[model samples]
Target: MFKHLKSDLPASVVVFFIALPLCLGIALASGAPLFSGLIAGIVGGIVVGALSGSHIGVSGPAAGLAAIVLVAIGTLGSWENFLLAVVLGGVIQLVFGFLKAGIIGYYFPSSVIKGMLTGIGIIIILKQIPHFFGYDADPEGDFAFFQVDGENTFSEILQTFNNISPGATLIALIGLGILILWSSVLSKKGKFFQLVQGPLVAVVIGIIFYNLTKGSDLWGISTDHLVSVPVPEDASSFLAQFSFPNFGAIGNPQIWVTAFTIALVASLETLLCVEATDKLDPHKRVTPTNRELLAQGTGNIISGLIGGLPITQVIVRSSANIQSGGRTKLSAIIHGFFLLISVILIPRLLNMIPLSVLAAVLFIVGYKLAKPALFKTMYDLGWKQFVPFIVTVLGIIFTDLLVGIALGLLVGIVVILIKSYQNSHFLHIEDKSNGKHKIKMTLAEEVTFFNKGAILKELDSLPRDTYLELDVRKTRYLDNDIIEILDDFAFKAQERNIDIHLISERGMVENPPSFIEFFKLRPKSA
Candidate 1:
């Protein structure tokens, strides 16, 4: 994976910028020490990324579980007790990974998976609009419908629109222009443009603007608009940031419950992210979800052993990595190092970089994810794919990540059922002779439980005293449930005075002893 160092390094820088504010904001929302979020980010990047099978996924403190973390900390009586729960949660996740529960990620539909990417893209674009305009009212990386800060996502955008900062807007526009120019033209010039990505350029420009505008009354972006990284005043203060779990709390039943909750939620969130990120991977690489779970478990264990919140594969950072041209997990690990070094050495310098520029970087990432061409392509595939895609998009934008995915999955399942019913094949009358009807029904290539209802309907609707021919010559596999449906129908066919003929790959059977018995007698070949 490290073979793509040229691409990975630049991508990692972009992800570092993207993940920085998110770590702090998520920690602030979780009601934990500011440094705890940084610890999670570092562990998630270095520990999880190193152990994971993913090519481009970046793990960190997640915004999805902020509410739960906030409430759990209070219920656990102290941060130390919460740390114990986090540790136990890591153990449970390790068990889950060993159990290979990650196979659940495969059950999600492709339509829903694509929808998740599109939805997240739209959400990123929508959520970052406020930050782009220099509205610092809401914390960074909050993807909820209702924010912990009491403002709705749309309302905050409106607020930002009303009170745009001149300096911030200028800097954002400049950053966006630089990104566009580099991607469109400068990138083709030489390796220099390739090595120095647009996002890095944007950051440099943002810092220059910050320094250049400090004395201008109308052009200065305030400290509120800058990236916020916690800076320790002294060596002892830095050492004091680490928090250890209290082993005495292990016996508490409530701690166990919290532990289970964190493990369950964090694992689920991580798996979902794994699916989404793989879909986003331009190489179409598949990550080993089980290994990802193990990596996340190890990271959480390490994070909890020190002082940090639970970690998961975060979409914002992962998406940023991909859009910035990350081709390997090296980008993720390197970003972790960036997080570690920044706080310890160059935090004040990082604080000088404006958030608007980072927001600009995210805007481009969002555009790529939710590109309009994607919607057109999905629409052309017909409603079966389009409806779920749009629903997932709307759900993520209107609700939150997990909820939107669930909604899309529900819609996808319903579409599958409908398709299954339709695929049971067509029934048509072939001939009528001597006051009797000859009916032919061609079975689909594969018939499963989903087709049982449709098959039963056709069986029940046959005319009395009719000749019915069931063709299974095209079918490669037949479910036992459908076979039983045929058996039950055979008894009823006799009652309705209907003659039955079965056609299969082997040969034709006229008036078989029993549909179930005949299928059983045949070699499993049919």
Candidate 2:
């Protein structure tokens, strides 16, 4: 893992910058204390990172679970009760790992996965718009269509336009401009710019701008426009900020439900992240999914115990790690360490960085995920792929991530079934030989109940006095429903003077009494 330290160190720094605001934002959305988010981020990075087999996948507090956490906390009555469930959830995830449930990740279609990434990318861009414009009523980067505050995403943007803070807006624009220049122009100009990431540069400039405007009320910039990192004046004060779990609420049934909710949601999110990270890995390395589940479970268990929100492998952070040229697990591990050190050692400095600057950084990240070219590429793949892709995208945009994926998977399965029905049976006509018509009916690889309708339709369409040959040489499975259809067809064939030839792996028979009995019949004395 440490083989590529030169490349990994720089990438780690990039991922760290990208992860900082996200940790805070997700915590804010989850309705957990702000530091709780940082705790999850730290555990996801340091603990999960060390245990994970994935080289590039990064772990952190996920925005996807914010709504679930919010509801769970309310239902459970106290944050401590919620933490108990989180710990239990982690244990459940570990059991999933041991059970080898990680194989589920491999079953998801690639087209659907791509659509998911694209959909998330679009959501990130949309969610960050208000934050980029200096709107703070909502969390900095909440992506759900409906927010916890009861405002729809679109409505929030409209509201932002009316309640715009001029100072915050101006600084955000300047920060965004600098970020764009750094990424597009400056980074390309020399190695220096590349070594120093654009987001880092934007953050530094934002702090400097905030300081310059602090003394002068003439700039119209208020303290709210600046970063709101909680700064504790002393060690005792900082220690006071940490919240302990309420173990007394363990008997509540709602607590168990919340734990199950976190376990399921966090596990799914982690699986998706593992899949996405594998796709992004330049070397195309496959991460051990079961191990990843266990690692994430451990991270969540630790995070929850510490009063942090549940942890999962987060795609945004993982993608940033990959795009920034992270080559090893060290990048993820180091980022977590940075999270721990920064919050403890330099809380005052971190408090000075503006939210808008982070928004600009995420804007760039989102654009890369949902590039226009990706839509065009998917369309070119034809409707079989495009339909599911579009369905997934729209579902995610209009609803939430899981719902969109469920809808897309449903469509994809229908497509598969339709294709299966078409291929289940085939009729072949042979030239007349000795004044008799020869018709050959070949069954598909697997003729199940689902194929019964198609097979029955073809058999019913056969004309009278047609010499028929039933072939099942390659078939692996024959459902009882299909067996009945064939048995009935044999009786009708005899009445119509249709010659019946049954072919199987064993050999050929001129006449088979019944489909079920045909398998029961032994080869005629070799």
Candidate 3:
């Protein structure tokens, strides 16, 4: 992990910059204390990062869980009680890891995973645009289309037009230009530019811009548009930010329910992110999913014990890390340490950085993930892949992450069923032999109940006085539903004067009494 220190360090810094505001924003969105979000981010980075087997995946307090955390806080009665639920959720995730439930991540289709990455990329761009122009109504991490501010995604963009801040807009544009120049030109010039990173430069310039324009009413970037890390005055005040879970809430059945809810949702989110992150990794390293669950479970347990929100593998930060040239888990761990140190020592300086500048950083990340070239590439892959890919992209833009994935997965499954239906069997016809229609039906290997309709349809459509050849040489597993159809079809063949010849690897039968009986009497032909 430490072998790529030079690359990892710069990538870590970029991830830290990206993660800081998100931690605070997610916490604020979750209706939890601002510091708690930082706690989750710290734990997610340091603890989970150290323990996880993923090289590029980064874990943190996820925006996806904000709504759940918010509702659970209210439903469970108190902040401390919610913390207990988070702890219990971590325990549940540990159990899931031991049970090897992480294998579930492998079941998701590649098209769906690519779709997820692209969808998130598009969301990041759309959501960040308002912030890019200095409209700060929505928190940084709120990726859902409908926001806590009572505005939807598109509506928020319209709102941005009326509330743009001149100074913020200027710095944001300048920051974006710096990023583009560094990424496309300057970074290619030498090793120094690579190590310094475009984002770090943009952030520093943004801070300078913010401070310089502070007194100007016409161009000033206000505190509202800046990073809002909780300002702790002294040692005692800083320590006081940590909130312990209420053990007294253990007896509450609602607490247990909330814990399970957090566990299930967090696990699903982590697994999905793990899948997506691996896809983004240039090295194409496969993360051990079960180990990831265990790491996240441990991180959540630590986070909840000390007044933090639930943690999960977050795609945005992970993508940022990957895009910034992160090569190992060292980068993720270092970013967590930066979050911890910055919040403690340089938070005031950190707060000087404008949200619009961060938005500029994210725009680059978003563009990398959802390049227009990818659309045409997916389209060329055919409708089976493209439909799910596009559906997922649109679903995420219009709804949320999990909902979009569910929709894409549903479409993927439907596409699979359709393909299965079409490929169930191959039917060939010979030029009417002796004035009687002759057809040969070749059943696919592993024909199941899904193929019942297609097989039945072809059999029913056969003309009277037809000569039929039923071939099963390649079939290995035929469903009983299909066997029953064939049995009935054999009876109909007699009424229609359709002579049947059954050909199999075993031998040929003029007419099988029952496909079920015939299969039972003979070995399953290979």
* Best candidate (score: lDDT): 3
Sorted by TM-score (best first), the order is: 3, 2, 1
**Cα lDDT of model 1 by residue, 1-526, tens digit:** 6689999999899899888988988898888998899999999999999999999999999988888899999999999999999999999999999999999988988888888888888888888888788888877757878887688888888888898999998999999999999999999999999999988889998999999999687999999999888788998988898999999878899999999999999998888888989888889999999998899999999999999999999887898898878999999999999999999999899999998998898888888888999999999999999999898888988888889989999999899899989878879897786777999999998899999999988888888999998998888788999999888888888888888888987788887767787788766756
Comparing 2 with 3 on lDDT, the higher-scoring candidate is: 3
**What TM-score quantifies how close candidate 3 is to the native fold?**
0.98
C-alpha local distance difference test of each model: 0.89, 0.83, 0.93
TM-scores of the candidates in the order shown: 0.93, 0.93, 0.98
Clashing pairs in 2: 80-246
The TM-score between candidate 1 and the true structure equals 0.93
Residue 231 in candidate 2 has what lDDT?
Answer: 74
Ranking by lDDT: 3, 1, 2
Give the better candidate number (1 or 3) by lDDT. 3
lDDT measured at residue 142 in model 3 versus the true structure, 0 to 100: 87
Tell me the spans in candidate 1 whose CA falls farther than 4 Å from its real position.
445-449, 472-488, 491-496, 503-526
Q: For residue 224, what is the lDDT in candidate 2?
A: 62
Lowest-sum lDDT 10-residue window in model 1: 517-526
